[model samples]
Target: MRVIDKFKMFSIGPLVPSAFSDGNDPKDKSFGCELFDKSEKNYHQWLDSRPEGSVVYVSFGSLAVLKKEQEIEILRGLLESERPFLWTRRKGEDEGKKKNLEYDDVIIDEKLGLIVPWCSQMEVLCHKSIGCFVTHCGWNSTMESLVSGVPIVGYPQFSDQTTNAKMLEEVWGIGVRAKEVEGIVKREELKRCLGILMENGEKGEEIKRNVKKWRILALGAVKIGGSSHDNLKKFIEGL
Candidate 1:
């Protein structure tokens, strides 16, 4: 079936598969493994240290890689937002060269922003302080953010991300598309998008309200008689 068809099935008043998290099974705990509390002391410390509603989480999922220039542009945009942010920049494959080290060598303000190789995304979303998510619109990450009740600033770059962005911005009303970055987003466009996302605008408030509605739908989908829950039960019984 087509992705759209599947999405329709899933949304037909709760009888479709429950694609709840970044996991094969809805209940899988280790699908996208997170740090233990003891091991993530630094992350936890940073979270605790920030003022409430002061940070944005920026991530592009696991498979996507940013060019050095792309990474720098993204950093510049985040810095321009003037709001604290948490960004994840994984080690690049071609980082043996010194040019790549520029990405590695750059220092971010510990108080305003934190960059890491990976992070407990679910945990981060659930935090009260996170006001917005600048995401690449991967379905798993999208679901995680909605479930956690946070709104998104969609910066779609590929494949399903475009579709997910549409769902968030159009259907679910939980996000805003950075249309200023038409075709592809650049640093300046990102800055504008982030500004609107962080600001208290009429559109942003609408997105927030719509996101809450979607959150209820998501939860209902996993409840006993919900579509996702029923589908899972049927599949298991068949197995």
Candidate 2:
């Protein structure tokens, strides 16, 4: 089925809280793989050590299989920014591709960042240490960032990601999109995008303010008397 047809067939009033009830709290639920229990303790330890709003959280959702060059460039950019970061590179997503590259050389400084295969995204976003999100503009990630009050640096890959990036930068004014040259988002662009989002400049401050505004709106939507809550209640009752 075409995308529009699928949407038309299943379009109900936005039933969001069902998908986002615990967005405001990191400890409210586990948003990671239940099988990977060890990472939970490590994540909490890392989060606790960092100061509030000091870390950049980077994830390309679950399906963006980036090329080795792209991954290297992203790492270089993050390193260039000279800020602490938590980056997720899911296992099996880029398995065979990293064979030709030396992982240790790319990730030179252990103190600068933490790179994991998978993580509890919602928990990381809600953490006080997270200052900004470096994302692929996936819908769930975008909404999660919004609810967490974290501004974004969008690195859109394809499909609806471009649309989401546009909405995040142009419509919502809460993020900046990195520009790609010849299908490659260079380290310079990544650094620039992160700078725009993370700096204490006027634009960055404005984005932070906008993020807070969206966060309040998102939390309110899930609260007892909010529109989304009422809509969900009515839908359930009617059923």
TM per candidate comes to 0.76, 0.82
- Over 1-239, each residue of candidate 2 has an lDDT whose tens digit, in order, gives 99956554332322233445544453464443433323422766777788888888988987888887888888888888898888877754343133222464763444677776677787788788998999999988898788778999998888899999999999988899989899889999988877877779899999999988888777777766777777667667756
Please give the CA lDDT of all the candidate structures. 0.69, 0.76
Candidate 1 per-residue lDDT, tens place, 117-152, comes to 677777677676788898989888898888777889
**Least lDDT summed over 10 consecutive residues: which range in candidate 1?**
93-102
Candidate 1's C-alpha runs over 4 A off are 1-41, 92-106, 180-184
Error of 1 at 136 (Å): 1.2
Top-lDDT candidate index: 2
**Global lDDT for candidate 2?**
0.76
